[model samples]
Target: MKKLSVIIVNYNVCHFLEQALTSLAKAAKHVDVEVFVVDNNSVDGSVEMVNEKFPWVKLIANKHNQGFSKANNQAIRESNAEYILLLNPDTVVEEDTLSKCCQFMDEHPDAGGLGVKMLDGKGKFLPESKRGLPSPWVAFYKIFGFAKLFPKSRKFGRYHLGFLSPDEINPIDVLSGAYMMLRSSVLDKIGLLDEDYFMYGEDIDLSYRILKSGHKNYYYPETRIIHYKGESTKRTSINYVFIFYKAMIIFAQKHFSTKNAGIFAVLINTAIYLRAGMALMTGFVQQTWLFFTDAFVMYAGMYVLVNFWERHIKSDSDFYPPEYLHYIVPVYVLVWGLTVFMYGGYKPLAKFYHILAGIVIGTFVIAAFSNFFDAYRFSKGIIVFGGMLSILALLLVRAVVQFIQHGNVKIGDGRKKRVAIIGSYEESKRIDELLKDTHYKLNVLGYITSNKNDVTQKGYLGYLEELEKLVQLYRLDEIIFCSKDVPAHRIIEWMTRVDNRAVDFKIVPDESNFIIGSNSSNKRGDFYSLNIELNILS
Candidate 1:
C-alpha cells in the first residue's frame, strides 16, 4: 500500500491545480504516495489538464459540481494508503512537507490528524492554521466584532485561537481543510467527513469527531505550504458569505445542544446579513473610489475654467445665472464621470488617453443635451473649455498618482512584464516555448541555470544560488521555476527567503504547458497555458 494518498478537490481553477500537482509531485518523491484529483465538473478544462499534464493522478471527473466534502469523500473511499491528505487545489507544498508530516504522525501515535503552518501567496501567516471551536459564546464574540478588535485576546478571539503562538506546535480545536492530513485507520474508525456540512464546516466537524474519539489534532509547523486563497470561490462575494455562514449554521445544529445550536444559528444568520452588507458596500466603494476622485478633479477644474470664462470671455460678471455654475456644471461633471466608467477608466492605473477620450465624449453628449432646456443652457465656450480643462486635470491626476504608486505613468500598454526563468538549459527552452503559446508579451531576461557548461547554457544569466542578486540586478517582475530541474523545496525556499513581494513566482510542472503563481495573497493564482485559454487571461 502507498504510504500517503493526496486527494485534491478542484473546481474551475485549472492553473492552480496544475501548480498544486507540480508541488505534490516533488513532495511525494521521498514517500510512497498515490494522488487523486476530484474535478467537480469544471468547465475550465480542469479534467483535460489532469489527463494531459498529470496522468498519474487518479481523476474522478464528476458530471456535476459536487460539494467539497462529497468530492473528498469519494477520493478517500478509493485511496489505498495508510495516510490520506485532503489538500486544496490552490496550494504549493515543499518537497519535504509530506515526509515531515508523515513522520510527525508516526511518532505521535495518539495523533489522528495533522495540519502544518500555512502562508498565503504573499507569505503572510494564515490564522486558519490553528482554530478553536465556535461554541455559542465564541460565535457571539466573533459575530459582535470582538474577535477582530481583540484578535489575540483569549477571552474573545477563540475562533482562530489567536492567543496561541502561530510558530508553536499547539493542540488546536480545528484543522483547516486546505491541508488536513489524517490516518486512514482513524478515518475509518471515526467515519468520513460529514456530508451534512457542505464545504466550510467539514474540517471542523471531522476535527471534533477525531478529538471525541480520544485522538489528538495537532498544529505542526515544521514545514509550510502556500495556499493561494479563494482560487475556486471569491471570499469577498455575497455567495461566499452565504455559503460559508450557512455551513457554520449546519455545524452548530449538528454538534451543539438544541438551545446552544439555536443561539449559534441566530448569530451565524446575523453574521451572514452583516457580512453580506459589508461585502456589497466594500465592493461598491472599491469600484467607485476612482470615479469619485476623477469626478472631484473634473468639478474642481470646471470651477476654475468657468470663473476664467465668466471674467474674460463673457465680459459680464452676472452674464451666466448662478444655477448654471452651481447645478449645471455639476451635472456635466457627473455625465463625464459616468462616461469615463463606461470607457473602462476605472481599471487599475488607467491610461491618460482613456481619461481624455471619455471627457471628450462626455462633453459632446452634455452640450447636445443642454439645448433641450433653457435653464441648463450655458455658454458653448464654457462647456468646451471646461471639457478641455477636465481632460487635463484627470490626465494629470492619473499620471502623477500612477507614477507615485507604480513608478510608471502607465500612459500606454507598451510596457510588458519583465520575467526571468530558473531551470536547466533544456527546461528553460521549454518554458520559452510555452510562453510563446500565450498572447501576453513578456520582456524575458533569460534563464538562471545550474549548468555552467558553454554547450547547454544557451540563455544563461547566472547560477540558481544567485537568484536574489539576479532579481535585483534585472528588476524582474516574475520568476518561473521549472520542476524538471529545480526541486519544490528549493523553489519554495527562494520564494520565501528572498522577501521580494514585488516579484511573482511561478512553477512550470515537468512536461506541462502552464506556469502558475500569485504575487499577492489577495489575488488569485493565474497562469498562461498552451492547450487552453482562461477568461482571466483574456
Candidate 2:
C-alpha cells in the first residue's frame, strides 16, 4: 500500500472543512493516508473544530490568509509521502477514491498528475476537471462568445471536452485543482504550485509545467470526488474577480506569447469594463430611487421596515443607526450601488468571488475617500470596520431575500434531479455510478435498457419501447441518451415522442460532426438552408 498525503487548505470554511474531513476519515479506513490541513488564518473557528474533532490529522495554522498555492505548498513541504493530493477543503471523497487514484498513478509511471471526476455538491459533473491547456485561439474564441456558437467544434471546444468520457482514462492538458493527485517525482522535477497565483489559475500553471517537463496529466474517471466548492469566497467580502484576473495576467505573462498576452489582456479589460458599466447603470437607477425616497418621503418607508423589525425583535433596534438616517446610509447605498454596477454585481450568474471582490473594492474606495476628505469625525479604523460590517450585513440580507424569492437556496441541499438514462447497461452503469458519486444537480432514477435486453441483469426501469409510459409514470424532467452503443434514429424517435412534453430531451454528442457543431446556433433566412461553417476554423 502506498502512503498518500492529502493536503487541504482552509480559508474560513469550517462547515465544508468538517464535511471534507469526515469523508476523508471514511476514505482513510480503506487506505494508508495522512491528512494535513493548512489553515489560512480562518476566523471561523475552523482550526479549533479540526483540533477537537480530527486530532489524528496534522494541522498548520497560519497567522493570515496566504492563498491556496502557498498553503498547499506549506503542507507538501512538511509531508513525507510519495504522492501529494492537493485536495480542497470543500470536497468529499469516497472510501476507495484515494486508493484507486494511487493505483492508477502507480500503473502509469509517466503520469505527472491524475484527476478523478469531480461532481458539484448537486451531483452534476464539473467540466473544468477535464480540460485542455489554454490556447490563444481557444481563449480568444471563448472570450468573444464565438465558442458558444460552435460548442461542439473540436478545435473550438477542445479544452472542455478533454475529459468527456467517464470510463476511459485519457491524457489531459490541465486538471482541476479541486482534487488533483500529483506525483512527488513530477513535483520534484517541475516544482510546486506557482505562488504568484493568489487564488485561481495555479493548477493550470502547474499542470502545464508538468506537461512541459514531458509528463502526462491524466484524467482518471474511475474514481470520483464531491466538491461543494466556493463556499467561503461566496459568503465573504473577497475581491475574487480582481484576484483571478491578477492570476490570469501572471499566467499569460509566463506562458503566452506577447501577442497572445496582449489580446488576453484586452479581452479581460473589456469584460471588466462591460461588467463595471452595467453595475454603474444599475447603481445609478437604484441611487436615484433612494434619493427621491429619502428626500421626498423623509425616509418614511425605510423607517417602517426598520420599525417592523424592531417591534418583532425588540433587542435589535440598533440594527440601523439613526446616524445613518441623515445622509450616510443614502451616500453609502449610492456609492456601492454604483460600485456594484461598475463591478458587474447585477450579473447574478457571475462568479461569486468576482461579486465579493467588487464589494471589497467598493468598500475600500469609500473608506479611502472618507479618510482623505475627513468627511466624518471618526477613527479611520472604526469607519472602515463599520463600513465593511454594514456592507456584509446588507449583502447577506439581499442574499436571503433572493433565496426566498428563488426557492433554490439550500446550504447543502445537494438536490439530485431524478433521471432515467436510455443507453447500454455497461455504459449506463458507468454513467449511473458517475452520476451517483457526483455533486451535480441530477439524480439517476435508474438506467433503462435498449430493446436488446443488454442491461437485463443490471436492473432497469423498462425497455426503450415502454420509455414513454415510464416517463409519464415517473414524471421525468429530463432524458439523456448515451449514443455510443445505441442507434441515433432510436434516440431521435424517443426525443420526438417526448417533444413538447414537460420533459427536456438531451442527447450525448458522440458523432464527430455533432460534437464539432455542438454549440452552433441556427437562424431563419429568406429560404431556410443548413449552415455548416466551422466557427473555430477562423
Number of the predicted model whose lDDT against the real structure is largest: 1
lDDT of each: 0.84, 0.66
Off by over 4 Å in 1: 140-152, 343-353, 433-437, 450-459, 530-538
lDDT of 1 by residue, 1-538 (tens): 9999999999998878887888888788899999999999999889998898788889999999889999999999999999999999999898899999999999999999999988876567889899998898998998899999999999999999999998899888899999999999999999998988667889989999999999999999889998888889876679888988898888888889999999888889999999999988999998788778878888888877777777898887777778876888789989998888778777754667777788889989998988998767777878888888888888887777767655777654445778888887778887787677776768788998766662345577888778889889999888888878887667767887777878877778777777776666655666776666653331
lDDT at 410, model 2: 37
Q: Which stretch of 10 consecutive residues in model 2 shows the poorest summed lDDT?
A: 520-529
Q: In candidate 1, how many Å is residue 191 off?
A: 1.9
TM-score of 2: 0.55
Q: What would you estimate as the lDDT of candidate 1?
A: 0.84
